[model samples]
Target chain A: MSLLKVENLQAKIEDNQILKGLNLEVNPGEVHAIMGPNGSGKSTLASVIAGREDYEINGGRILFEGEDITDLEVHERAQKGIFLAFQYPVEIPGVSNANFMKSSVNAIREARGEEPLSAKDFLARMREKSALVEIDKSFMSRAVNEGFSGGEKKRNEIFQLAMLEPKLALLDETDSGLDIDALKIVSQGVNTLRNENNAFVLITHYQRLLNYIVPDFVHVLADGKIVKSGGKELALELEEKGYDWVKDHAIEEQTA
Target chain B: MTDFNEDKLIEEVTTSDYKYGFTTDIEQEFAPKGLNEDIVRFISAKKEEPEFMLEWRLKAYRHWLTMKDPMWAKVDFPKIDYQDVYYYAAPKKKPQLDSLDEVDPELLKTFEKLGISIDEQKRLTGVAVDIVVDSVSVKTTFQKQLKEMGVIFCPMSEAVKEHPELVKQYLGSVVPTTDNFYAALNSAVFSDGSFCYIPKGVRCPMELSTYFRMNAALTGQFERTLIIADEGSYVSYLEGCTAPMRDENQLHAAVVEIVAHKDAEVKYSTVQNWYPGDKNGKGGVYNFVTKRGLCEGENSKISWTQVETGSSITWKYPSCVLKGDNSIGEFYSVAVTNNFQQADTGSKMTHIGKNTRSRIISKGISAGRSENSYRGLVNITKNAKNARNFSECDSLLIGDKCGAHTFPYIEIGNSSSVVEHEATTSKVSEDILFYCSQRGMDEAQAMELIINGYAKEVLNKLPMEFAVEAQKLLAISLEGSVG
Candidate 1:
């Protein structure tokens, strides 16, 4: 069974149609890399699937575990084990990262009809996850993302992903501003969290991330549609030939 | 099932009921519904005050008649008819109670419902609670223990009879009768409040607290509180208030004064949760209060911290007079307004002596159709050489319909004084809410987390128990505020 399925999804933000009849499928344990140019509807697909209210679904449906979830609220999707590593993590002053993660973890657990985690267990989990992401223990007590450098904020995002342990995760431009060492650490965190019961969708403009965490499949997104899809070799081809041929090939196929 | 219709949800949540809106049914006594010299005499006579106190009350009453209501605050309300309010009301069958067992069961149940169990506070928190209901002191717990530490903690009415010399010396000494209209009215007809006096070189063993509740209908609650920390002594005091739901707006005018002598420190904290009327503002309490502290001798310090989350209309400025050389003063406040509530509250710091210093931090939050304002004054007097003052005022608006304003007045008379002020206004952005929601928090929970964080500085100044209560009040005050 598929972990997620999007069929002919159409979405728009205020009058601009960003995702026009986009379709994709992710099976359990699969890693899918979405490569696209600027304004190519890659982020829009991730947002629409995560149920962001800013985007209006013009047509089509989203299914999670064979259940229609197109009209669910953002937090509802989150409670059902969907997580989005924000491109720009927000800075909430005076709210410690540990406190924020605790609230998030408990909220998800509550939705699953589980008792809240005890202080001992919660602190232990935080310690383990901070170690996994190579974040300093001091960062746990500081304000969430406040005064954090670009690399630190990206690492915090991965730390949160490990804490939540969502069933399906979407990394939206997570590697955009990361330095080489920070990127390696982030990729290692993701690799450690990947399992057969969950899936990952990595959206990026650069194929450098694929070198560290190789994908099972690669899809080229252009002008609000998946222009081409293939195995891992397609990512290397696109990396070698800079996305121009993919558009020309897509146009040729359309005209043919 | 978790789909949130933003508008509908806000509508449903904003009109949610006030949790502390229930009234206590007890036998009560009342003086006539009017404000006059005779009524002032009536209140004083009921308390059996001394001749000097009666003369003071009459003088204040005469002065009040010549004064007019101050309309400078940024609030709107119907005109108050002095003749329509009951000047005095108290529970009948009041004899000197020996213990909590002697108190009426109904009154105990009322305190229980308010979650301020006097017994629990006495046993666990070691707080001496002096509870005032309907403008009369019901009980003062832990009085004996406090007395062993040379602390004079009792009801104001009792202090007049037992400690007349101290009362006569300090009453109206910090805040004069001519301070303002409400202060004058409170001086003339104030019924009951707490009084604390720490002897020289003694530190109070327990936190002194007062809980004020308005129970009777059509009655105005006027309470006066006075604290005098003697030279080299220390004390921490807490005040909390609430009222029942009513269709007619009730009035509460209070006066609080503190005097800290050489090397002494006094910390006063208030968590005011008065009833703030219905969604349309049909009924609520009009809170007009005057509170000031005096740093009387060198090295003295005084701090005022308040969390205000109730009342339909609030006009208060808890201020400090840094009179002693090398004295220090601090004021921290968090005022929240929702529905049709209006609050204009802040602090006033007057640096008088040489080398004095003061600091002010004010946070205001407005939601629904309410208006919240921070009005503060920092004055560096001409002779206050090398005096310094720092003030920070921040406002947060929840919905588009609400308003937040900052009115800061700074006056520097000497080149040696250094004064600094910072102000900022912000709205709860949709992006922040979206981020929290994406982390599995619903709109309401996310709002709570963000608002608490914004007011964490001021809330942290409160005592541990009061900090918890203030956090809950912030969440309750902001329900259905975000759209």
Candidate 2:
């Protein structure tokens, strides 16, 4: 069964139709890269999949684990093993990173009818995950993303993703402002966490992040629709030819 | 995602009922429903106070009549009719008991329902609690243990009778009878409160706490608390209160005064959970309180920490007077106003001695259609050379209709004195809520986490037991406040 499937999903924010008749499917153990130009509904697709409330679902449906979940709340989707690494992570002052992760982990545990982790075990897990992302021990005690640089925020998001251990993780422009070193660190964290039982959807405008964590499938999104799909080499082609080449070909095919 | 209706969520949040709203059905007595010279005399006689005390009450009552209710607070309410309210009410049955077993079963049940089992508190925690209900002190636990350490801890009425000299000496020393409108009223009609005095060079062995409750209808509660720490002594005190829900607004005016002598340190903490009005602001307690402390000798210290999450309209300012050179004064507060509640509370630090230092940290949270404000004053006199003061007031608004305000007044008289003030106002933005929700926290859980984090600085100042209870109160007070 597919881990996530969206069939002719139409979504909009207010009067602006951001996702019109978009369709995609992701089976378990497969990484999907969503490469699109600006305003091509890349981020909106990721947000809608994560159950963001701002967008209105006008038609169609979303299924997760072969179960319809179009009406689930954002937290409900999260508790059911869906994670979104925010494009611009919000800063929550006075809440420590460790505390935030603890709450998240416990909420998921409760949703699964499992006992909460003890303080000692939670700390041990936090230490292990922080090590995976190269996040300093000091960051665990500091407020969540509160005085962090762009790179640090991205790293923190990846650290959270590792801690959550969701079945399907969506990275929305997670590589936008990261330096080469930071990007490598973030990708390394994702690579360490990936397994056959879980999958990732990497949303990026450039193919630079794809070089580190190679995707099995690269899909081009244009004007709220997936225009093309191919192997990982498609990313390389788009990188060399620029997004305009794909857009021109898609328009020509539509007219023909 | 399932869409949340903002209107429905707000209605649900605002109508969250008070948990401790049940009234106690015990036989009670009332001083005829009115306030006058006769009522003052009646309350004084009921407590069996001395002549000096009666004279003081009469003086305060006379002064209160001359003064009008101050209307400068940022709150709206109907004018209080002093003539229609009961000035005093207490349980008709009074028993002199040395143990909790001898207390009235009905009163015991009331306390148990409030989650404060005296027996459990006695066995698990070494806190000495002086329980007062309806302006009357019912029982005081651990009196023998406290007395052995040269600590005089008892009810104010008991102190007036047993330790008359001490009471007469320092009763109104810090907060005078003419301090304010409420303070004067409290002095004139106050019935029962906690009284503590730590002897010179003796450190209190355990925390002293007082639990107050209002059980009668149409009654105004006025209590007086006085604490004096002698030279080189230290003491920490805790206070908590609640009231039954009612349709007719009740008045609560309290006066608390503290005095710290040379090298003594006093820590006072309060978790006030009075019954707030209903969703439409129909009925609740009007809390008007006067609390002040005096650092009388060199190197003395006084700190006030309060978590205020109750009352429909609150007008309070816990202040400290730095009269001793090298003295220190600290104030930490977390005031939450939800539904139709309005709170205008903060602290005042007055520097009078050389090298005195003071710090103020106030956090105000407003939800529903409430208003929360932090109004503080920091003053350094000319003699306070090299004095320093730092004040930070932050306000958090949960919804668009609610309001948060900060008014900081600073007066520096010496060039050497340094004073700094910082203020910020922020909303519980939808983005922040979405971030938490996406991390698997529901609306209530997310609000609790954010609020606890925002007020951590103030909450940390409370003692262990009070800190836990305060956190729970904060959570309950803001439940369903956000969509």
DockQ, all models: 0.58, 0.71
Candidate 1 yields a Cα-based lDDT of: 0.90
**CAPRI quality level assigned to candidate 1 from its DockQ score:** medium
Q: Candidate 1 — which residues are off by over 4 angstroms?
A: B1-13, B480-483
True contacts kept of each: 0.51, 0.71
Clashes of each: 0, 0
Worst 10 residues of 1 chain B by lDDT: B1-10
Query: Model 2: residues >4 Å from true position, as ranges?
Result: B2-9, B481-483
Tens digit of per-residue lDDT, candidate 1, span B302-351: 99999999999999999999999999999999998988999999999999
* lDDT, candidates in the order shown: 0.90, 0.91
DockQ versus reference, model 2: 0.71
Predicted structure 1: clash tally: 0
Candidate 1 lDDT tens digits, A62-141: 99999999988889999999999999889998788988888899989999999999999999999999999899999998
